[model samples]
Target chain A: MARPTIADIAERVGVSKGAVSFALNGRPGVAEATRARILQVAKEMNWRPHSAARALGGARADAVGLVIARPASTLGVEPFFAQLLSGLQAGLSRQSVAMHLMIVEDVEAETEVYRDWASAHRVDGFIIVDLKVRDPRIEVLEELGVPSVVLGGPGRHGSLSSVWADDREAMLSVADYLAALGHRRLAHVAGLPEFHHTQRRMRALRDSSRRLGLAETVSTTTDFSDAEGAAATRALLSRARRPTAIVYDSDVMALAGLGVAGEMGVRVPDELSIVAFDDSVLTRIAHPAITALSRDTFAYGRRLAEVMLALIEEPERRRDVKTATPRLVVRESTAPPGAWQGD
Target chain B: MARPTIADIAERVGVSKGAVSFALNGRPGVAEATRARILQVAKEMNWRPHSAARALGGARADAVGLVIARPASTLGVEPFFAQLLSGLQAGLSRQSVAMHLMIVEDVEAETEVYRDWASAHRVDGFIIVDLKVRDPRIEVLEELGVPSVVLGGPGRHGSLSSVWADDREAMLSVADYLAALGHRRLAHVAGLPEFHHTQRRMRALRDSSRRLGLAETVSTTTDFSDAEGAAATRALLSRARRPTAIVYDSDVMALAGLGVAGEMGVRVPDELSIVAFDDSVLTRIAHPAITALSRDTFAYGRRLAEVMLALIEEPERRRDVKTATPRLVVRESTAPPGAWQGD
Candidate 1:
């Protein structure tokens, strides 16, 4: 069967094609009763506007682009990304905007996608995540002149609007909590070093350690995978003098580190303590219920979508918003350091 | 700077507008050297084909649509979805095809989206997941005459291509494994009852119990959320004559059930056994490490993308490809029932 067009609807409703077009576009010059009749006939005939034709008439794409440059294997297991995605969808779907998503190889490929989508007008705006130190995407987005929202940053976005949580404060709170529990020897399993948030977290730990006159503090970087998280934990525990407390950058990694501790006969909260930087179902349902920095990631994503929509509607009104700081939620995982256990 | 145009590229290359067009479209009309020079000039000027114009010329959208009808909050925690999404991106990105995604309210909203996207020609094809027992979208898609691949089905998709795993056989294997482990009274915590795969799994356990002469087999349904999964488990364990072994439809639910058992002083693999229908890092890192039915979900997603691409390229070559059935991987979570543990 042939696709129903405006002409078909017009004929069925005993109206002119021009009147049907005006009714469908919700423009003036059509009577209210006639518009309703036209719409009913159109729905009955299953008529839909050709999006390309609408695009030619300067209609909005009604979609946003999210290009992630990360390993797919790691992404699947990480609740952070999934929850954020769900949240972003929740916010965008309310406004009838879809998300055009892609996973690219690296920053360079990601920039190319931005250029392509910008030129094609495939999306109304872009939502950028995983902000890095001296990020290159910011400059590219600036040059493209596209309305965008950076998911990370209190600063360093260079005029781009952003929605960020206080990562440094969150990390410092964790360090303070562990230090008060007499954990002088501290260690951190961090994510990729290039990310701004990772640097903030590492610096927070170092500053806190120096202020507290701690014996030793170390930060090891990984690719944010469970394998790397477990390996990092193994290396830390294998030392002749292992730290009494360790913090992981993500819940998946934290859980893996907990498993490593179990395998090595290190009783959590006794000889050693563990904390996760992010909280999800994984952290809550674990055997000992891992201690974690808790924040609502789904709500964060919704806030991001809200920011993007606002920016797109009024690109001239740039805003930098800071969200609530994540609070440390102590569970069954932390305690005062016991006498040093030799390897 | 204003957007670059083909005419501007033609002027720079000192070629006719027709020659520039031919070279840009990869049509054989311009000489090889001239074509290369035109391409170089076009790239230097950052020229891109306007997608709307290309669409009017009958070019492919270079995208696929995936409209999900589940709640966004539940979706974020499900590893099965996150893994499949990653895999689908891995496959589609290989060919530079983006996934246009939307989360809608229900089946009616989802079908409306299908019709809108199909009529708009905004995607090359559609990838449908979570097939229903009496799906209405299948006929809508058939009437639209759009190329599509159903991710669930051994049958029931009329005149459409499908790539499915043997859900019934996979469930049978799980039931057999539990029955052989000396578990008699079995209960299943299932996903939404309307889903075809859920029905298959529930029926498999029922048939297996009758054949194996097991006592008191039952299946309870939920909306596939950790909250509901926990509530269902709580109700089951509170019974005077609780089942010796329980199977959960997802890893998150299984983990939640483990936590509940701990809260209730039920020893896993001793007084009660647990099995999850899916597996991921959640199962692996759990203290007791849940026994689960496992499949390579990422690879399954890639396979779906491949099949959708094939169906789009040659719509006449309809195929119902069967992928490998998921296998049961026993972990520390399941064992024989020890002398009845009275509530």
Candidate 2:
């Protein structure tokens, strides 16, 4: 008969993989009864630890864990991750470290994943992204004693190191550029308001709009889907007093906005100037080649991975990295508000 | 002293973590001399396998492997993967199976991954994508005695089960619809030619175009980047005898084509109709709501995962799944040739 695996033992014991891992590792988290049951089942199955598995003896796995808590629908369309992953892989590959990725639906489930990987020693460390205002995962990871590097900011992570792009400054540049182009009324099609960076960018936009003395700046929240982006555009365009310029948090949203504008017979640049936050292929390929706050996302990921490795190898060497400010790339989508007076 | 880790041994021996895994497991892939040295070093370090890893034995890891060999930049913006991944996760989560994802650059490197994962017993089976004309990974996977499910057609896989969409039928539908719309001269922006589905779709397009007695049907290859799509579109549009309609392999490419059309003073659906494959939010949100070959991508992913799990559980069950035929969604992007007589 084939040797028994972890799944078999867990199934027999009526416990989770995490629970089994904890019990086997003699980790304190598992209940005494549960541990005993798991041990008994494992022994009955005649499951002997593979010699290779035995040789490591509490050694590092030389791997890092990354868990994303978002709907797959949102995760798939967002270019942010793909670019970041590439950069992360580039850096991690240098150290031959494996990246174990898991996608969960919420903070609670994501926390569970952390526990599972931690108890198993499946990963030496972690790289966290899309940090919330009061992220629960931070505390859980801390308790696990696993090193982690947050992508957004370090403010709420206790002592965890962070890497961030000055999105606030980038937003300011976007608002200032739009205002300079004689755009009075403006709209901001923003991402999920819960994320730290989204909140920062929105705050920057509101502050900059107030300072610019613009007539109004209406902001709408979205799940970062193209459908929501179009709906937001439609709602903003149907307004009694419509905005002349609109800034989107992502290139996909901006492209959707462009499509909405076209459908509504709004001439881009002349009637409704558009600005996108990230400069992705979508922005570059758009009709007017959308104006955007561009930064090297690949480099951002690579830097975070480098920091993660450092944190894992030397827990005391906590450091923060501030990515270069996003530069505004002026494209065909932006123009003086009254350039085409006929409209 | 701290517990000896895999990283330290790898560093000392100047070999890879994969090599160490092979050597310690008594796996035949490692050289005899290298294996001897690895065992010696592991003994000297007083490294014994962690109980957590050892408990796994010859048991199922409750995980399946997925490897994507693509340029990260292209992978990031492509909506197809994101949508599919959601489905895969949905199906796998239901079965409590973990999906282990790896991104590699080429087929050879991809083969190495299959070997490593197989030797380590990290995954029970694999779900392969981007199947080439004569895939090397198939042979290696078979040799490793690991069950696998291919995402493309099963024809070239030497007995491996597969799950695929009827892309050929979909391509034919696309051609038939465009022909009915009175578009004779046509252009198709295709994905990487190495993939079996790309070749099949191309063949179907050519056959249907010939059967329909079209004036000409020219095709261009792209790496699926919007830039390449736009370049292909530009080259096609600049032709003296330009096709009235263009079909793109992906929505991102079609969006790029739209931008090129706008720049070249061509109006979509009026002067030049556009059709995009694999309907995405970009297609739905586009100005004219681009005509596309639509399919349930999430469902596709879910089904593939389900099949992978089945393959792992019952290696004797070699089933082929044909994903539902893509329905042609006629949006505003396609119309009779020169519908705008003025143009």
Candidate 3:
């Protein structure tokens, strides 16, 4: 399908394609978001840019690289990457940069992929997704002296620029919403234990429950999906002290929890409240729309472009920028309890 | 991230990236699917045969010109493209072909994008989505000798190759399923009136209902979204003689109907029954899994690749080929109407 080209991107962003062209070519003109979406589509088209000053040269085969040692299965289910990639692509597209995707089975493979892309000049820079408790990629990328951006801040603190979202506030909002709904006992179906965000969300949720004067229990899932969400939800609902609410690390998990509630004969917002992270369209139209923290993946895309450019322009200042704020959107899935419960 | 490189593609498909490169060059492949995916992905990566030939290669822009021809707003909300494009990408990824997308606001602009791409060699071919009774694009493409594929067949028995799910068979399956469930009355939520598939499905449904000895009522929607589907569903349910079952052109529509049933105080598969098309993940996980006529979009993509190549290779024999066949996937959404309405 012939879609809106740079000309359309230019029109929407209120500029010329040449201006769009200049911004995309890593020159300047047009706001960051407009440039990002153009870049995103350009990447989607696998469009490449050459900075050799030939003006719209061609593919370098040296794409921008991303290395996260997570399971390919896990990455597929995670909304963070889904949205983040969407954002990254948006930003990269305008620049006509290509993303060469690879899924390593483990950390060793991840490092290997990173080392190879670097030595082979397969990528100009790397866009790192997750930073581990002690992520080795940072050291590897630094040692290689290849340009890159970590998706997370230097945990414990560092010189690397990171694009971080506040899951803590988002979790606290979930707890606050459930507590206000008169729920005493609550449970959170979190993501894998090792993830940086999972820990942050779990800790924030526990603190929020205590702060809100509500009782809480927590469950961790190695897999963030509807199957695990359903299983976790079932365990909570079947207990003598069943939780009045449940929060999920993913919208997919939250979606699964809906069916689990249906299976246990529990009614949403009436018998139990539900909250999900990543307010995607899937969450918005869920039978009883789950309350969620809203972060625009599309806008997340815009910001990724900004940080990438900073890394390109002022590599020293890249880490100083903050990209997004996670905010809460209350919907039909969360409400006061027992109105439809089997009490 | 280093994924399967063109070298990997050459190895897997059992050809050299040069031969894989040449076949990908659209010279000829060892077989059909092999060359198609390579060419597609080559187009996607915006890869060219000669790096030095960047001034403009011997071929076109590699875009499969798509003219929405409908209002842009209507196209965005319809998940058809989202899912369809996902399939299209899956198929094209093998060949590395990416579409140069454009949303034409007028008929002339629509025709111009094609001419510009064709004349300036901007696109290798065109992909016409949402076909009408006597699509003008077909005539235009024929005159241009441009290689193209239609998502839906034109009504006039044209000599163009098509890759469409058998909507007629799917509609009849819905009627037969309802009849076997002992439902005497049925309604269909067909898509846009001018759409060829919608017309085909509606006519088949009316005929099938009569054959099954049941009365039929059909409603049409310009928007093929869950929202409109739900609204149409609500209108039918509110009627004095509401049908016992509802069939929809898409799973999205069926999902909307599910919400409508819930809002109308109708318990699904009890007071009402539902069936849908496109057995997406949503249908599988819906509270009661939805019954549907499922077609593999993945396979559809792969085959579309084959057909497009055929059009490329033997343009004189472009009049043959159907890529997808609709099949029944029975699930929880269809059942007898209570214990009283037995078959």
| Tens digit per residue, CA lDDT, model 1, B1-343 | 3467789999998999999999999999899999999999999988999888888787899999999998887778899999999999989988889999999999999999999988888898999999999999999999988899998978988988999999899988988888787888899999999999999899998899889888889999998888888899999999988988899999888888888888899899898899998889888777688999999999999999999888889988997999999898989998878865422
lDDT string, candidate 2, B13-51, tens digits: 999988988887788888889999999998876565543
The TM-scores that each candidate's chain B achieves against the reference are 0.94, 0.83, 0.78
List native contact recovery per candidate, as a fraction of 1.
Answer: 0.78, 0.25, 0.00
Q: Give the alpha carbon lDDT tens digit for every residue of A68-142 in model 3.
A: 454433433344555565556546645545455554457777776666555434456777776665776677677
TM-score of chain A of each: 0.93, 0.83, 0.77
Question: What 10-residue stretch in candidate 1 chain A is worst by lDDT?
Answer: A334-343
The TM-scores, one per candidate, come to: 0.94, 0.79, 0.64
- Which pairs of residues collide in candidate 1? none
Model 1 residue B229 CA deviation in Å: 1.8
Across A84-119, the per-residue lDDT of candidate 1 in tens digits comes to 999999899888799998889999999999999888
Chain A TM-score, structure 3: 0.77
Best by lDDT: 1
Segments of candidate 1 deviating more than 4 angstroms:
A6-41, A339-343, B7-23, B26-40, B341-343
- Model 2 spans with C-alpha error above 4 angstroms: A1-56, A183-186, A209-220, A226-244, A256-271, A338-343, B1-51, B218-220, B234-244, B261-267, B338-343
For model 2, residues A1-343, the per-residue Cα lDDT tens digits are 2445688889888889889888887889988888999899877765545424643465666568888777765666667776777788767766756677677777888887776666556678888898888888878777767888988873867777888888889889888888887887889999998888888888888898779988888789898888899999999999877899999999889998998998899999888999998887668656678998888888888888899988888987887888899999999999988754322
* C-alpha lDDT of residue B324 in model 3: 54
lDDT of 1 at B184: 82
Best by TM-score: 1
Give the clashing residue pairs of candidate 2, or none: A5-B59, A49-B54, A54-B48, A54-B49, A55-B49, A56-B49, A57-B48, A57-B49, A57-B50, A76-B82
